[model samples]
Target: MTQTPVSKAPVFGAPPRPASDVSAAVGLAGLAGLMVWVAICRAWPEIGAALNLPGPRERLAGSSAAVLALVFSGTPMVLWSLLVDKVHLRPSTGIDWSAPRPLRAVTDGAMTKLAGLWATWGLIAFVYCLARWYWRGPYVFAMDLLEQAAPLLFLGAIPYVLWLDRVLVEPRDGAWHFGAMLIGREAYDREQVWHHLRAWSVKGFFCAFMISILPGGFGAVVEADWSRLGADPVAWSNAAISAMFMIDVQIAMVGYLLTMKPLDAQIRTANPFLAGWVAALICYPPFVLMGGGGVLDYHQNTAEWTYWLAGHPALLWLWGGIMVVLTGIYAWATVAFGLRFSNLTWRGVVTNGPYAWTRHPAYLSKNLFWWLATLPFLVTTHSLVDAVRNTVILGIVSGVYFWRAKTEERHLLAADPKYRAYHAWMGENGPVTRRLAALENALVGRRRGAGEGVVREGGAGEESGQGDRHPAQ
Candidate 1:
């Protein structure tokens, strides 16, 4: 019998599969800088304490700390980019530098590098300013929101900016190659990689923020005693629902981070419509913070029938169940998207899970939940005009979501051929689409029956005329 040949294992130091070296090196450098900064802060308690103190002295100390952080972070990246460009990058081969790259390119790369280093300190300064003013000002409660949100945003922005900067400027001449081997496919074009990185970096920040806030919810749930549950079921139910919402948020964050396998490069989105963008912006922060002048605020739409029904146990359960189901569906859509889930850009064509049923399952379910929760139809109003106005506003919000769905499809169809195929399949196979087709068919059949009767009557008249002309014939 012939002996089976054993395959040789890859050598330990073999250039890392020639994946996106630039991305890898940049990432490593960023981490190194952060580690160094953290170590310095740990070793020197005076610097940390000075930075945290209140007022002008603290601000000056923070600025000095930020400069040090930049120095610590920026050095590794500059050196690595230099080493790779000079040593690893060759004239004849892999990435596209025919001649030696100028020193200017490397210096330009440092701008974003500096920006990333300063992101955390910048956030800290902003929060301090906001807290100092807002806490002492009329909106005293805003301070509480600040404390809960600031740390999440600050910590998240550090990595977000680091990746963001790496993508912002493409130094093809540098030792780091622009092309990245993603999802085990061909090397991604520099542009594609840039877009993918930008989208994810921003998306990651949002996900991180969501993940960070989860601990507050966990703490609340943990501290809650079950013995107190029966005393006020509505409050307990609300608390439980809130807890589940946080869990859904955590699932989404993890799914976004993990599902980027096989290179996560499935679909890329086309440019979205301006109206859709505007509508989406109004629903989120900064714009939402602007108060009534902002496009539309969900808080303005007070709850109606559902909140009232909370007093009754059976109705309350039904309402709570519906909300929970809707939340689960939203989360399910995110999970279905896996690593492809991002707003504004197309990541890939996701056709499984809730997507198989309807094209915009998350948006559909979410809007439905909102409508149910708000029940604009049953909302109390001072006047009939007010009632109509409230209903119209709610309708506009629904219309915005509908337009968002249409625009997303348009983007996906143009960008991903797979999405185009999926769109066709969904039209034919989706549950909602099938139901709409059946309804249309019924309407057409009834119209055809009515038309046939009219035709028969007209035919009799024509035959009588012909018989009159031909007598007995």
Candidate 2:
């Protein structure tokens, strides 16, 4: 009897991260950071008034600020969950669309997104406030920060809570049996549900979002132009930059929310997303840590933001064009390689999708999207230079990709002979690689048939109307 084999390439490009999953953890941490910033700023004046702030009180204040940050960043979910159960919401498998029973129901997810959004936007306002405070223009304490960010904080709540909860709520059993209406509940098969969970994983979103943050973060690094903050022209400019940053973050989040899923959640052998995230976590933090807002020393300012954004439009044109044209091609290739290969015991050589065009479509797209998304935040002349740098990095990463791809192919080939054949066919079709082949070809060209005396045919040395073989005409 013959055994039937399964191919996993049926779903290559994962679903976008649902808004809920992507934002929840990050928003929680961000909220904590912002709240701490707010509390410190708010309390500074009063604390200073009570005691000489330059003395022990200042140190105490800083310590308190750090502590507040830690708490706000870490524990809000625990509190929310504790109270959530106290409110007696059922362990649902679907959405409850009929007015969350009480405002508190709406408040949970809504407040979280709103708070997170506000905190981020508020950080933008803080730039101006910091500037004003430095210039001695009366933007003194934390209240100033709140006042500046208040509108955003309030308005932001609308999108965050409404959208995220909808994504997260599971119907008690795949059908929210509400009063005359079925809410975010639909029948779900285990396979589809698992697919969804995998699709919405953090790795899908983090790759793009992290890449772009440097520019925005850099914009936040400038010492507040205190005088300009209180003034009209600069104040508005600052606000605009803040708004832009907010838009970018959300854009990145949404992109992840909607596309790029993983194979599973357990970070085990079966999951592709965990691997993607693990790869991203390794590559991303170091670059970002050395970049704009992640640094302890300074954040990105308008100039920095302007500078970074300059590179994006061109990159978007180049890579976006490639992806658009290649994605369909990628689909065919993903399926073909997946099936013909007949097995996947290989190492991390992802030869599906656009990988057929080039060995490292994932690497290329990752950098392309990262730089493209980052361009809006920092519109600068250095965009090309930065691209060049990224290209260099790609060269290095390609080495790893090569090793991984090779290992994976070997594994597949070992498991199934058809995979080995397909691999060779692809190699024969000319994988336009940029590495050793070029130099080797060049070296070969300089020596091989250097002075061939072959007869010319057709237009070069023969009659214009003639075919190469006289009788063939």
RMSD of 1: 18.7
Candidate 2 worst ten-residue window by lDDT: 464-473
**Lowest lDDT block of 10, candidate 1:** 464-473
Candidate 1's residue-wise lDDT over 73-111, tens digit each? 445544554565341242212323334344454444443
lDDT of 1 at 51: 68
Q: Work out the TM-score per prediction.
A: 0.51, 0.27
With candidate 2 superimposed using the best TM-score fit, by how many Å does residue 276's alpha carbon deviate from the native? Answer: 3.3
Report every candidate's CA lDDT.
Answer: 0.45, 0.33
Model 2, span 80-180: residue lDDT tens:
32343221232222334454444456454344334434444444455545543322322233333335546774676476446535534431211112211
TM-score of 2: 0.27
lDDT of 2 at 234: 28
Best candidate (score: lDDT): 1
